[model samples]
Target: MNSHKQLFILSCLSLVLVLLSGQFGLQVEAGHHIHHRSKKLFVFGDSYVDTGNTNKSKPGSWKEPYGITSPGKPTGRFSDGRVLTDFIAKYLRLRTPITHRLWDYTVPKHSLKYGMNFAYGGTGVFDTSSSGPNMTAQIDIFNQLVQENVYTLSDITNSIAYVSVAGNDYNYYLATNGSLPGFPSFIASVVNQTTINLIHLQSLGFKRIVVGALQPLGCLPQATAQTSFQSCNSTFNDLVTLHNNLLNRSVTKLNQEINDHNTFTILDIFDGFRTVLNNPSSHNIKERLKPCCFGVSSEYNCGSVDENNVKKYLVCENPESTFFWDELHPTQAGWNAVYNELEKRGLYKILY
Candidate 1:
C-alpha cells in the first residue's frame, strides 16, 4: 500500500466502507483432489475482497478494532478478522493472494504463489464519490501486469477469478440522490457493466469466474439502524433482488453465448446472508443486523475518536457472537458462517 496519505477515498468512506486464508505450496491431506488445474486465484472487487489493496494511510480500514479479531491490528481488511477472499483461497488449497498494492520489503523475488488481489475498499463497477479505482481500472492494472509478463498466459487460463460487487454502486446512487423511480434502470446498468467486466476477463483467458450476488442492503446495519437493529428495510432489499436477478440472467446468458456452462457463476451471497439473518441461532450470532462496533452517536462510527484521541465508537464484547462488524461489512465469523452456508446450498463449485 502507498504511504502518500493513502488515496481511494469514498463518500462517507468510514460510515459505509462497503464490502458491502491458507499456507503456501504444501498440499493438505484434507483435500480430496486439486491436481487437474492451476491453483492460482485472482480476486477483484470492493472492500468485501480487498486485502489491503487500498492505501495504508486511509483511516477507516487502517484504524483500530478493524482487524482486532485475527491480526490484533488493522491490516487493511474491513472486517475484524478475515474477509471472503481468505476463505475462498483456503477452499482452493491456495494461500491468500498478496495485495496488488502491497510491496513487502522481505518478499522473495521468486514471484507470488497465488495470482494477485486487485480489489480496493469502497470501490465498485463504476466510479463513485469514493474516488477510487473502479472495476475497469482494476482490470486495467491486471492487464498491465500481464503485459509485463509478471504472470504468464498459462497462469491467466488456469486461475480462478473471484469478484465481489457489494452495494457500493447503489450506495453511490443513493448518496448522490438518484431518483427512486429510475433506480431500477441504474441497477440494470450496473449489472451490464459488471457483465462486460466478466467478458473482459474471459477474453483474458480465465476459465472459471465466481461473482457474488448483491447482498441484502436493507439488512446491513446501516439501514437497520433506523429500526434500532430489530428489522431490515424491505424496500432496499427489493432493489437488491432486482440487481441479483439481472446479474444472474446476464451471467447465464454470457455462459450460453460462449457455450461454456461453467465459465461464469454467482456465489449466492444474498442467500447466505439471509440464511444467517433468518436463523441467527444456527450461526451462533446473537444479533443479526446490529453491528458489533459502532459510534456512540450518529456522528461517530466503528473507529472514531475525539480531539484528545479518545475513542468515540463502541465495540462489542466478542465480535464472533455478533453478525455485522460494521455498518457495511460482516465480522470474520459472519463471513465464515456465510461461506459455510453457501457451501451447504451447493450454489456452485470452484477450482473443480
Candidate 2:
C-alpha cells in the first residue's frame, strides 16, 4: 500500500485508541447535567465561526453561493451554509450571537440575549490575508464593549466564550514562505498567544471559554486540489499536529493554573475533521476531498462573475453529498456531520 493509505489507517487506529482511552476527557454518557446558569455565547477567531463580521463589499463570503445551502444568500459566512458558530449556538440552546456590525443599529439590546459574534473571516491570531481585526484586536473589541458596559457583569458571568483560531496563522505562514525549521516556533507562539487570549476572556468574566484546535490543513481542498483530491499532504498535516499538541498542553497548563478543570475547554477540530474524513461513508459523505463549488481554472472561485456578469465557476449538483464547499471551507452537511461527531464525543460538556 502507498504511504497515504498507511497514514490513513494509522490515524484511524489512533482515533479509536484515543476515544477508548478517554484521553480527551470527554464524558461518554448519553445524558448530561445541564448548566442553565450560562445562556449567552461570545465568539472570536476567524471564518469558521464568523457569522457575518467580514466587510460586506470586500470579502468573498458576502458574495453569491456562499450561503446557498441554508439561508440561500450570502451572509458573510465562508461556507455554503451555517458554520461552526451556528452549530455551537444550537448546542448551547441559545440564539445565534449577532454579528458585531449589526449589534447596535440593526439589532436591539434585548436581541443580544445570546451575546455577540466578533469573529472575522480570513483573520488569524495575528494579521492575515484579510484586513479584519486579528484575534488580539477582536478581544480588544470585547474589552471595549465591557468597558462601555454593553454587557454587565451578570451578563458576562452567565455567558460562554467560543474562540476559533482555525489555521489562518498557518496560512499566513505558508503564504509568506516561512521556513520549515521555524514553523514549530511559530506554532508555539500561536499557542502562547491563544493561551493569553483565553486568560483574558476568563478575566473578562466569561464563565467558560472554549478554544478550537487547528483542523487538518493537509486535508483541505486547497491542499488536495494539487493532488486532484486523491490524497492529503502529510507534511502539512504534521504542522497541524504540532499546533494541536502544543495547544492541548497549553490548555492543560492554563486549566491547572486557573485551578478550575472546567474553566477552559478545547473543541477538538483536529480529530473531529479526521474522524469525518476517515469515515466519510459513515457520515453519508461522498467526494470527501473534492469541494462542491470551485473555479473552472486558477483565476476564479465559486461565486466569481466577470465584468460582463459571466459565471466563472461551477457548483456541484448536490452540495449536501460533498464534504467541502470551496477551497477552504466545508459544506453545511459537512459541518453537520462533524458536529454530530463532536456531540457524541463530548460537546455535551460545553453545552450543559
Candidate 3:
C-alpha cells in the first residue's frame, strides 16, 4: 500500500475508536443516573402515608381489613392494603422502609438503606384526633436520628422526603366545634407550618422533598355518609380547595427562594383525587363515595367486631372496585390509581 493511503486508514480507525468510547461513556453515565435515582425515602405526615407508624393497639389501622388487600392482614397502614409510601417506594425501586417506630436499637444497621417512615395515622402538621406524633414531632424524631448518626449526610442527600398532611387537623377542628369563620385561618396555619416543615427537611439534607396537597375532605365517606353516599358536600370541598391553593402557593414560593426548581415539589393530591372521583371509570373505580368497608350503624367502622365477636362492619366482596376502604382512607387500588395519575404527571422528576 502507498504510505499516504496507510496513514489515512490508521486515522480512520482511531476516529472510530474514539466514537465508540464516547458512546460507551454516555451509556455508563445514563446507567449510573438510573441506578442512583433515589437511595432512600424519608416519609412524614399523616394516615395517607403512615405505613405502620401508629401504635398497634391505638389506631384501627392495626386492626383487621386494613392490609387485607396486600399483606393479607393488618400492618398498621390505614387502608385495605398499601398506601402512598408503598407506591412511592415501588416507583423508586426501593423496599418500603420500615416505620420509624420499628427502628429499634436491635435492628441490623444495614436496614436503614431504605430510609424510614415517620408518618402517624390520623395525625397532621399539628396534633389531631389521634395521639400519634404530629408532623413537627415526626421531623424532630428525624432530626434526632440525624444527630445520633442513624443516617449519614450522604444518605439524606441521596434520599427523598415524602410529606402527606391529609386534612386530619381540619377534621379535628370541625369535630371540636371550631368556628366556621376561623376555618380559613386554620387552613393558613396548617400550610404555613407545613412550609416550615418542608424547609426544615431541606435543611436536614434531603435533596428532594414531595409535599402532598390535601385531598377532597368533603368527598370522604365520613362527609358523604350524610347524603347516603350519593353526593359530596361542596361546602367542605371548598375548604379543601382553599387549603390546597394556599399550599400550592407556599410550595411555589419555597422553590423560588431556594432557586432549585426541583428541590421541592407538590404531589397535588387534591387534583389527583378530584380527577379520580369525577371520572371513576377511567381509574376503574366503581364506587367513589361509598366505602368498601363500613359500620352497619353510626357507632362502628370497618373491622369493628361486636362484643360477642359478631362483625359490626361489613366489607365489600371486591375491595379493588371501591375507592375507599373505610370512612377516611382509600382502598389499595384507589391509591394505586392516584399514584398512576401522579406518575403520568411527572412523578419521575421527584424520584430522579
Predicted model with the maximum lDDT: 2
Candidate 2 error regions (>4 Å): 1-30, 33-38, 104-106
Q: Whole-model Cα lDDT per candidate? A: 0.85, 0.87, 0.86
Clashes of each: 3, 0, 0
The residue pairs that clash in candidate 3, if any, are none
Query: What are the runs in model 1 whose C-alpha is more than 4 Å off?
Result: 1-32, 35-37, 103-106, 347-351
What TM-score goes with each of the models? Answer: 0.89, 0.89, 0.89
lDDT of 1 by residue, 1-352 (tens): 6644354443445324232213333332333443323568898899999988778777678899899999999989999999999988877767898988763343564447677899999999999766569999988998888898877888888788888899898999988999999999999999999999999999998898889999999999999989999999999999999999999899989989989889998898999999999998998989888899999998999888889999999999989999999999999999999989987776335445
Q: What is the lDDT of residue 8 in candidate 3?
A: 100
Q: Write the per-residue lDDT of candidate 3 for residues 1-352, one digit (tens) a residue.
A: 9999999999998787667656643222332234353379899988899888788878388888778888899899889899999998997778999888889635787778899999988888888878888999999999999999988899899888999989888889988999999999998999999999999999999888998888998999999989999999999989998988998888889889978888888888887888889899998899999999999999988888887978888899999999999999899999988888887787767567
Please give the lDDT score at residue 335 for candidate 1.
Answer: 94
Predictions: Cα RMSD each: 13.8, 11.4, 5.3
**Shift in Å, residue 13, candidate 2:** 44
